[model samples]
Target: MKIALIAHDEKKKDMIQFTTAYSPILKSHQLYATGTTGALISKKTGLPVHKVKSGPLGGDQQIGAKVANNEIDIVIFFKDPLTAQPHEPDISALMRLCDVYLIPLATNMATAEVMVKGLEHGDLSWREIVKEQEGNDI
Candidate 1:
């Protein structure tokens, strides 16, 4: 499964901790993340992640494109709702794209924990089929 991770500036620490806790489960899959968050996670968990530009610099849209193309199966975006974001529109569009693509998204730590636990178990096996099909040539 391909998983995309993103965290607002204020939530980056929590994202790091969450990924660290779930690194074993996450290690079996490909990971993608925005610039700073990806660097931070890599530092903390040593997980290889494809890093894109910072979100305000269009990283969210990059992930959104992957979701639209069915290249990503899940998204864990730790957003701080209490704080305003300069790139709120991009964030909103990314969420909308996730919905449009029928992908699972976790916007908070609690929901992210549930999804990660599901992945740790066998509940996300369906993603393997999707990934296999995606790898096959017609």
Candidate 2:
């Protein structure tokens, strides 16, 4: 499975800890993230994360594009609902794309944990079947 990790500035620390805790399970999958979050995860957990620009600079949209194209299976985004984001529209678009593509999205740590565990327990094999069907359409 391909997983995308993203976090708002206020939630970066939590993202780090969460990624560290799940690194063992996560290491087996292809990982992608926004710029600073990716750098921090790589430095702290030694996970190889493909990175796009910072979120405010368009990373959210980049990840959204992958979701729209059916390249990413799961999205974990730690949003700071208390604060205002300059890129709110982009974030909304990303979430909308995930919904449109039927990609699983975790906006908080609890859901993220469930998604990761689901990946570990072979619960996401359905994604492979879905991908195969998508290929047939092409």
- Report the number of the highest-TM-score candidate: 2
Q: Could you tell me the TM-score of candidate 2?
A: 0.98
lDDT of 2 by residue, 5-106 (tens): 999999999999999999999999999999999999999999999999999999999999999988899999999999999999999999999999999999
Give the alpha carbon lDDT tens digit for every residue of 1-138 in model 1.
899999999999999999999999999999999999999999999999999999999999999999998888899999999999999999999999988767999999999999989988879888777767776955
Give the Cα error of residue 58 in candidate 2, in Å: 0.7
Please report, in order, the local distance difference test score of every candidate based on alpha carbons. 0.93, 0.95
Q: List the residue pairs that clash in candidate 1.
A: none
RMSD of each: 1.9, 0.6
Query: What is candidate 1's CA lDDT for residue 138?
Result: 52
Clashes of 2: 0
